[model samples]
Target: MHAKADQRIRVTLTLNGRERSGYAEPRTQLCDFLRHELGATGTHVGCEHGVCGACTVRVDGRASRSCLMLAVQAEGRRLDTVESLAGEEGLSDLQQAFRRHHALQCGFCTAGILMSCEEFLSRVADPSEALVRDMLSGHLCRCTGYTGMVQAVLEVARSRRLATGPDSQQENNDV
Candidate 1:
């Protein structure tokens, strides 16, 4: 149902390490809220039916399709968009790998692909090529044929695994 002015709900969430709050209609999609209200445009809305994975984002440290979630449902949750990965020094490790491997072409689907890979790499540090392909199965990319994308994610995961051994298996959940 559409929320009236008085019925508009308040949604507070932590985004990119910063606390942010916004008002939303009861039926407002999380994808719309992020792009329009929160200015986190990096989370793209592709098919809007959650098939393309273009609206992927990390909600409470897990990859989710923003298009399939309602804004009000995200209250009290921590959201991390693609914009959260950047730093003053330069791009994040995943982004760097994507660049080095030429993983992206038009870049429309790059954000979602990277986000999915982020969540995957967090849990699996030493993934195989088959596993990487399986991880990317949910995403659809017409350009680059996904070869570069898989390679980029693999590179990041391998390096991170080496840096953090069994004694220090810290997950990269600091999005």
Candidate 2:
């Protein structure tokens, strides 16, 4: 049996470091819920089949396709959208690196790529250019040609390694 399109459920989750709740039909995609109900418009919807990766968000500390997930599936999960990247101080290191390297142009594919790169950096503190490119294979960008994005990721990795020192690099890599 399929859930009625109008049957809305109260979905709750930790979004962008804050507790957020919204009503969504069982059939509603998470990206739609976040954008329409929760006002997380930063998680753009593109190629809803999950190929373009424009709708990526961090769910439980991993990059996930919001368009491919149901709203109910995000309940109790810690979700981080592109909106969470900037703080009062301004853009995050990764975001700053993106800006400096001109990693984005049209910006449609940037949010998803940023989310994926953020997760990548968290798991791999010191990554080679090949590895960064491999990780970027999941995303598609029509504007920047990926050279700038690749450079941004590498620059951020190097900066983070320097900021945290060599000892922390090993620990971060082990994660």
Tens-digit lDDT track of model 2 for 26-76: 889999999999988998999999899999999988899999999989989
lDDT of each: 0.88, 0.90
lDDT of 2 at 1: 41
List candidate 2 stretches off by more than 4 Å.
Answer: 1-5, 170-175
- Candidate 1 lDDT over 72-150, as tens digits, reads 9998898888998889988999999999999998999988988889899988767899999998999999898999998
Please report how far candidate 1 places residue 121 from its true position, in Å.
0.8
Best of the candidates, TM-score? 2
Our model 1 lands, by Cα RMSD against the true structure, at 2.5
lDDT of 1 at 157: 85
Task: Count clashing residue pairs per candidate.
Answer: 0, 0
